[model samples]
Target: MSSYDFVVIGSGPAGRRAAIQAAKLKKSVLVIDDRGSVGGVSVHTGTIPSKTLRESVLNLTGWRERQFYNRRSTDNPQTNCAALNSRLSKTLLHEVDILEQQFARNNVHTLQGRATFVDKNTLRVERREADRTAVELVTAERVLVTVGTKPFRPDNIPFNNRTVLDSDAIVSDLTIPKSLTVIGAGVIGIEYATIFSALDVPVTLVEPRDSFLDFVDREVISNFTQQLLDRGMSIRLGCSAESIVLDENDWPVVTLSDGRVVRSEMLLFAAGRKGATDDLGLENLSLEADHRGRLEVNPKTMQTKVDNIYAAGDVIGFPSLASTSMEQGRIAACHAFNAPMPDAPHHFPYGIYAVPEISTIGYSEEEAKAKGLLFECGVARLRETSRGHIMGLQSGILKCLFELKTGKLLGVHVVGEGATELVHVGQAVLNLGGGIDFFMENTFNYPTLAEAYKIAALDAWNRMAHERSGKVIKLKKRKVGKKAA
Candidate 1:
């Protein structure tokens, strides 16, 4: 038996960050993961793998170049499962190696095993070597559970990993089909659907909700929807999968509740994901996970019911991006060790890597209206910029919202190329409490997508000036009418 200051289970983004943070504080840290390697799901199956695959598809198929060329020929490069797998493999290996080295340098010990709670303070890890099985019991002053989540596989869906697959299997199997039917319009489904569609494979996206990406700004969503439609992807809204059956040829035929049948060479069911906590023996700690297998934690502190135990990332649920998860892990480690935690910003940017790409931070017009905030909006189309002309991008938008009275920037939303990377400028302003004036005052590099910020700011400034002038004229008219009366 060995004892340490902190023990982190599952070396995903959250676990890795927490362990390293604690170790940096000179605390003895042990990280336990079943995968036999660092980087966990984020590096292996989820974020890195999917994003790398998207980049590979875009590069290999000349997706970005197609806007200008418009040439369709057999000589054009095509991507297959092998090529994508090769890229994903290389990327994952590099990421894992970096994480492993980081852990070693920080003096954080890592054990490859499945971790189960012996009690609130102790963990029993099971490991298997080539010819022997071993068990190790480790005690810790604090524990962080960051096991992440797995794709929800419903029994009704016949997943053969060839014709039909879940989100995880889709990346591993890596087959390019003639047609694909993706169930669930969530982030994962939308990403894969668009990736395959970009490859010129007919894709049908089915969502049970009437709205797609409802959390995103409606304007951004509208633009993204149009981009998908323009790319020839079929979107079926407010439709649920009644059943998935195989035809005589053994291809998947998805029956919708709306009396529609969609037959595709392959199917991807990415409805949702559940936390990977089934084997952690939470019952021993008297901790109850939600129906989705997610553990509840204090939003600010990331602490569970047990004061010393914390949870982060997908296992804790909501805003499960690698970026946010890393922050959560750092905050959790800080709280666990009683370190001074910095104040987190009220707003964080959300990035969706769909075909056209969407990124947003702060409030949307609809949200501002719902909250009864006095707000005005400014809009700029990418086509209005020089960069858009050079890149042949006709469809892209940068929308900015400002509070009418104070001229404070309420939100920034963007859709189209480079939206994800370009959103950081908005995030910086929002975090620093800077308003529209910041964009108007600063000079962005000319002929760049970033210049859209300045354009949007000017639009809002003009609108505000016009409204103010109109109000003054109305006041003068009212005074004149009162004097005549």
Candidate 2:
């Protein structure tokens, strides 16, 4: 038996952060992962893999250069599947090496095995080496579960991994698919669909929901949809896949509930992901996970039903982002050690790494309306900016929402090139409670995307002033007419 101050299960963003934070406080920490690698899903399969592939495709195919130069100068066979896969392999290797060094330098111990709960404070880990299996018992004063999530696989779908694939498997088994069909219009589906579309592959996106990314600002979604259509991607909304059959060529033929048929060279099912917790044996602690295998925790402290045990990352659900999960793990570790938790801002940014990307922070226009708050919105198209012209961008938008009565900035939403990076400027202002005056007074560098903030702010200011002045003019006209009569 081995004992430690903190034992974190799963080495995803949340688990890694928690283990390292606890170790930095001089507490002994041990991280156990079934994969035997330090960089969890985020590094191995999810975020890193997808984003790196997006970049590789863009660079290898000269996506940006083709905008200025002709396609003849950019298109080549070197940007094919083999080259893209090679780039993904190189990037993953580099990331894994860095993570391993970090864990070693922090003096955190790692074990390779599947972990199951023996009790509230004890875990039984099963290790398989060659033809032999071994069991070890480990106890810790505090335990954190951050196993993350996996793609949901329904029994009805025949996932042979040859013609059909899920979100996780597609990254590893990628080929230069001639035509692709993607199910679901969530973040993952839209991202992959657009990425392949950029490669000039015909992509059909099917979603059961009528609206795409309803949580995002409608205007931003509208622009995104238009861009997808302009790129020759087919979108079928309010349509569900009734069945998928393989044709004579082993290609996937999908039948929609609406009686539409889509034939493609390959199919990707990315409808949703469920928490990875079935092997954790929560029943021993009398804890029950939800239908999706998610555990509930106190929002503020991230403590599970048991006092010493905590849950973070995708296992706890909602806003399951690598950026946010890292913070949750750090905070959970702080509360476990009775240390002061750092003050976190109320608002956090969300970034989707699709082609022409999308990112936002704070309220959406619909959210402000649902709350019944008097607010106004200002928008600036990327085409209006000098940087947009230089980059040959035809479509992009930056939107700002502000409280009508107070003039305080409430939200910032963006869609287009560098949308993820440009959003921080608005995020800073929103978090600091800065109003229209902040952007008006600030001097942004000329000929940059950041200038969109200044343009958006001015648009809002003009509208507000026009409304106020119109009201005052009406009052003056009434007084003059009364006096003359």
Candidate 3:
């Protein structure tokens, strides 16, 4: 029997982060993972693998370089299954090694097995693979569960991993289908559909909902939708698969609710994912997971029904990016150990690694409108900047919203090259209560995408000027503090 101050289940972003945080606080920490590896699904199957495949496809096919050379050849990249996933395995191994070293440096112990609650403070570890026949029990003063989720596979969808595949299969047992029919236009489905499309494989994206990614600013979605359409991807919204069956040749023939039959060489069902909590024996703790296998917790503390236990990451649901999960894990660790937690940031950026990247932070246009905030928008296209020309870029937009009364920055939305990395500038200013004056007054480096910030600021400045009877819009003067770097 082993006892520790903290025990974290599922070595994903959340669990690993929590374990390390607890160990750093001078507490004995043990991390348990059933995957038999340090990095959870994010490294082995989820975020990293998918993003790796996207980058690999982009690089090998000269996706960014296409504008400079033979567009036809680069547009239709030739690749096989082995070459596509060759770097993926290596990347996962490297990530795992880094995580393992971190744990070692922090003196955080790790156990490999399935973890189930024997009681609120007791956990039974079934180490079947680690040792042919060993069962280990560990006791914890506090616990964190971050098992993450698995792809939702409806009974009607035949997930054979050959013709019909789930999210996991897209990374493992992957084969380039002659054509692909991706059901569910969520982040995962959209990502896979576009990845294959980049490979010149025809893709038909079907979503039951009339709108997908409703959280994103509609304008960004509009731009992204146009990019997809321009690239020859078929988007069928408000359409669901009525039936999915295999034909004589083992291809998936999908019949839609609208009475159209779409037969594709492969089908990817990435509609949604449910938390992996069913086998965790939560009944012992009187903790009931929702229908989706997600646990409800206090957003501030990450505490569940049990005072000594906490839940974070995808298991707690919504905004389930690996980045957010890590934050949630750290918050849980701080609460568990009664450590002084840092003040929460004003907003977190959302990054979608689709063909043309889309990243956003702060209130979206829709959100601002719904809140009835007095706001004005500024816009800049990437082609409007010198760097866009140097990069041979085709399309990208940066939009920023500012309150009409105050010069406070509301939101920043971007679509195209380095959108994910470009969003942090907005995040920092927004959190620091900075305003458009910062962008207008500050100088950005020449020949850079970052200059789009200054460009967008000027656009808003001009709009504000025009709206106010051609009078200059000046922010109210106040006591000034030192500026942020």
Candidate 4:
């Protein structure tokens, strides 16, 4: 039996970060994962893989280059699936190497094994080796579980990794289908749908709900929908998949509940994510997980119901992003070691790396309205900016919500190229409680997309002035004008 100051299960973003933090605090830390490598889901299948695919599509298609070329520029700029797969795999492996080195530098032990609770303060780790029986070990004083989540697929659909794919298997493919049917319009599904569309693959996106990404601002989603349609992506909303069967050629024929059948060369199920909690032996710790096998934790401290344990990332639920997860992991470690824990960022950006991108931070328009707060809205169209027009931006918009009375900025939402990066400016303002007046008094350089922010502020100012003057005129007109007429 071996022991450590801290043990983190799953070498994903959260687990690795926590282990490193604990080690930095001069504590013996061990990170155990079932995968042979580190970097976990984020590097393997979730964020990095998806973004790499998006970049590959953009580059191969010369989508951005088309802005400067004639529409008749018929050069396809050919790229094979093998090339993409090779590049992505190489890049991911390199990243994992760097992560491994980071752990090594921090003196954090990396174990390739599966871990489960044996008691409140004990974990059983089973390691596998070639042509050998599994080796078992007991380790850890305190544990942090950051196992992440797995793609969810309906029971009716056959998840034959070759033809029918989930999020994990989708990225490992070296080929693009002629036609693909994507179930679910969540982030993962939306990303792949757009990537395939950009690659000239016909895609039919099916979502049972009328809307997707309900947490995001409605205006942003509306803009995304238009962008998807403009790119030749077909969407079927409020439609459920009744069944999926193979055609004569072994292609997928997806039947929707509305009696509509969609035939495609490939099928992708991206409904949602289920917690990676199976086989963890939570019962040993006297703990149980939810329906999705996700554990609940303290939002601030990230400690589970069991005091000596903590959980973070997707396994802990909403806003399960790599950036947030890393911070959560560090915080959990700090708290566990009784070290000084810094305050979490007052405002964090939510970035959706879809085609053209979408990002937001701070309050939503509905949230402000529901509070009955007096507000003004500022909107900037990408087409109005010289940079946007030069970039061949057909559709891009930035909107800012402000408290009318106090002139304080409430929220910012952006949809367009580099929108994810651009939203940080607004995030800084909102976090500092700065108002539209800041943009009003500042200059954002000529011909830049950032100028749109200032332009939008002016737009709102004009509307507000007009409303105020109009009200004043109405009040005077109702006073009889002292018989001047």
On residues 198-225, what C-alpha lDDT tens digit does candidate 1 reach at each position? 8888999999999988888898888889
* Index of the highest-TM-score prediction: 3
Q: What local lDDT does model 1 show for residue 457?
A: 79
lDDT digits (tens) for residues 236-347 of candidate 2 = 9999999999999999999999999999998999999999999899999998899888999998999999999999998898999999999999999999998899688999
Q: Residue pairs in steric clash, candidate 3?
A: none
What global local distance difference test value does model 4 have?
A: 0.84
Residue pairs with colliding backbones in model 1 are none
**Model 4 poorest 10 in a row by lDDT:** 475-484
Name the TM-score of candidate 3: 0.95
Estimate the Cα RMSD of every predicted model relative to the unseen true structure: 5.6, 5.5, 3.6, 5.8
Estimate candidate 2's alpha-carbon lDDT, on a 0 to 1 scale.
0.88
Candidate 3 lDDT by residue in tens digits, 20-67 = 899889999999999868888898889999999999888777789888
Worst 10 residues of 2 by lDDT: 476-485
Q: What lDDT does the true structure give each of the candidates?
A: 0.88, 0.88, 0.89, 0.84
